[model samples]
Target chain A: MRSVLPVLTIVAFILGFWTLAVVPMNIHLAADQAARGDMVVEPDDARARQEVGAFALALGNPAVIPMTYTLDRPRLPGPQQVVVELWNTVFAVAPTSNRSLIYHGWVTLSATLLGFGMGTALGIALAVGIVFSRTMDLSVMPWAIASQTIPILALAPMIIVVMGALGIQGLLPKAIISAYLSFFPVVVGMVKGLRSPDAMQLDLLRTYSAGPAQGFWKLRLPASVPYLFASLKIGISASLVGAIVGELPTGARAGFGARMLVGDQYGQPLVTWAALFAAAITAAALVGLFAALERVTLKRMGMAA
Target chain B: MVSVDGNPQGLEHSAKTARSAVISASSVDLTFQTNDGPVHALKDVSLDIEKGDFVSFIGPSGCGKTTFLRCIAGLETPTGGALSVNGMTPDEARRARAYGYVFQAAGLYPWRTIGGNVKLPLEIMGYSKAEQEARVRRVLELVDLAGFARKYPWQLSGGMQQRASIARALAFDADILLMDEPFGALDEIVRDHLNEQLLQLWARTEKTIGFVTHSIPEAVYLSTKIVVMSPRPGRIADVIESTLPRERPLDIRDSPEFIAIAHRVRDGLRAGHADD
Candidate 1:
């Protein structure tokens, strides 16, 4: 409850800024719409309005300000318009409908989850190999780091085209892109976590005559949990971004990315804004879920303060 | 073969004078090759620790006191000379689980309870769950940390955490216990109390103990034999045998005999510094 006030204050500030920006951004459309109703508009010409700076045109036609929030196809949709569209798409329509945000969210989310699982498993396996073997440490780690530097945007389309040529289509290609994006963070974090034990701790294990397998299970694996969750949160968000970008190039018919592209092509900014907000919310929920799990696990293990 | 007959003062093992050497190092040398140059961490370091003897190695930093202890525990390889534990090579003795080592820090796993941390060695040694629990219980009680078995290390005081570490070392019931300044991080008051408890523990366990420290009183009060070492090509400068009886009290430091031994250790340390 104490935290609610500060969060609400921040949300209100962003909404207020958005409300103010709407008039300038949609001034040309609002002016055209107002002129149809015989209302006063700057220059009384739609073509002339586009040449004018949005802020200058908005200042010139103050009377059209009230109509900016109500434009049918706003250049930048107002916050309230996005909220209404979100409500209609998310709850007003059946989940199976192509127009429903839930349907699109589910499509992206399933891909994200599949990719996240594969990436996490692969990352941990690679990290263990690197930690235990000098060859993997020397050979794979540099490549893993170098792989991340190749822009995911440039790589996503290439991956889709190659995978498509191989007769793989739809979710698998998108999931592979997500796995590529997420695996690096997990690999780096797990390596650090698995190697976190100090020299003294390792020496203590050596004194016990513990085998490498015992050392890993009794010391390294348990030690890496906190670090694993930290990377997992970052990986999930990156995975979502990867899935959305993956959709952009493949011309996918359904998913948040498809909804965004469709909205842009069809001049429906409200649909794009709604999909954008839904994706942000999804990312937040996934990260929150991991954080809660981390707390519970660390608490049980007596690692948490 | 270097004989153990040179150190006349270190022969004060009374009734246990006939006991065989559990750990014997003759001309044990270790030189660490580094980017800067070769570091003579230990040089011709020789000592014999008889069974059930409480031996303390006291020296300043870089004196190879801890390094010698590490060599004994088979955590470090000697580049030269011969060292053995229980008539076997240090590596062989380690594989046989002949000793338990306690480090400077507690090094308790945050993810484990005190009991779980204590049970770590037992678990690795393939002890049954029931036996692990039993040993954990016994060691925790031995360290006066019986009530803290379920608590995490962070919840305890520094003193209590150190005790928990001691309990962990004792859990495996090994014949030899090697400690490298285990109480170096604790407060002086806690140090004194722990020192008393340690002597009692040594009496109860009858384990061959090798301790490293920088304090004179701690060395003289706790050790049956004190090996005073020097830095820079680290080697033993003096080996002093304590004349004190087996039964010792905390106030024994105030006794004339304890002070005399402490003074000799202090002189040995200064002489080591002067040589460099």
Candidate 2:
């Protein structure tokens, strides 16, 4: 209840401020329309309006604030309007329809999941290589860091063009992009986690005459679990961002990013905002799911999850 | 190929008389080449530990006592001279599972319960499931930690965790047990209790135990033989064999013989400093 109260209050405050912001952001259009409809009534305090505040003046015409909420293409849609739009796009359309946020979300989600899986596997493999081999540690790790310095924006389009030229379309390109973004954190995190065992513990393993395989399976691998999960949370989110960016370049017509592109081109900002919110919620859900898994796995290992 | 017949020391000769000497280190030396310079950790270190002997290496910090124990466990290599365990090279003996080692810290895998930590070695040695369980239970009982086997290392007290580490060492039934200041981290009261329990444990198990510590009383009361070491180019200053009987009570620490042995150890430490 205590946690819920703070969240509710914050949401309410944001909505209140959003509603107020929409009036000013859209009031010029409303005023222009009011004038065009021959409904302009100059307030008695019109001369004093400049000093009294624009909000006080806007409050004089109840129709103006309400009209702002109903605009065809509002600059900043009111909270109620966004809520209504969210409800309509989610429930009013068939899930398979192009207009349905569910369909778009599913498309983006598929790419994100695929990319995340590839990224995590690659990251762990690289981490293991780096940990076991000093040459890989000295050579590959710096290169891995250097790879991220090339902005994904510049890289994504090039990848998309290159892959598109080869006639590889849909999920693979996006998954590759996601894999690129997600692998770094996993490598960095897994390296640290695998090395977390101190000198004494390593010596203990030595005394047992444990082979490299046995040491890795019994010590390094289990030791890396908490770190792996931490990286997975970061990697999964980065993968989602990668998926969205991957959608941006291809002029694709299916994913959340594609819907956003349509809304952007058509000036239907509600569609763009809805798609943005859907992506955010999906990322949050993925992180939450992994956190639960981390808790359970670490707890079973007798560690503080 | 390896012979230690030249040593004129009575302690060295007594080990030969037993015909069951488990560890023999003759003129063994280790020099660590660090960034600063060469640091001689052990030099001309000669000793023989008979089977079931409780040998303690007592020295100040950085005195190479732990280094020597590590060499016996095959965790460290001597740069010069010879060391053997159970008539085999340390490395070969290690692979043959000749000994179990307990570090200063409990060194329990935090992810494992005490029982699981104990079972780790058994698992690595390819013990059957039933055998693993039986051995883990037996060792835990020996360490007075039978009830706490299911608990995590963090859940136990420092002393209990150290005991669990000892239990881990004992779990595989190795002939030799190497402990590097296993109870040094605990409070005095706990250390005393663990020392007594360790002596009892040694008496029961009859494992050839090599312990490293700085505490004179601990060295005197727990060991059949004490090797006092000195710092900075570390070397053995003196080796004292206790004349005390095999059966020792907790009150043994208060005995005149125990005090006399402790004084000799202190004098050896002081003399090492004097020689520097």
Give a tens-digit lDDT track for model 1, residues A30-146. Answer: 888888897877787778878899899888988888899988799888888998999999999999999999999999999999999989999999999999999999999999989
* Error in Å for residue A227 of model 1: 1.2
| Docking quality band of candidate 2, CAPRI definitions | medium
Model 2 misplaced regions, further than 4 Å = A1-13, A41-63, B1-18
Candidate 1's TM-score = 0.95
Runs in model 1 deviating more than 4 A are A1-9, B1-19
Question: B1-276, model 2: which lDDT tens digit per residue?
Answer: 222224345345474645866899899999999999999999899888888788999988988999999999898899999998999999999989999899888878888889998999999999999999999889899999889878888898999999998899888869899998888889999998998898889888888899999888889888888889998778888888777777888798888877887888899999888866
lDDT of 2 at B270: 98
- What TM-score would each prediction reach against the true structure? 0.95, 0.92
For model 2, fnat equals 0.80
lDDT (0-100) at residue A207 of candidate 2? 86
Against the reference, the lDDT scores of all candidates come to 0.90, 0.87
TM-score of chain B of 1: 0.94
In order, what fnat does every candidate score? 0.80, 0.80
Interface-residue RMSD per candidate?
1.0, 1.3
Residue A297 accuracy (lDDT) in model 2: 88
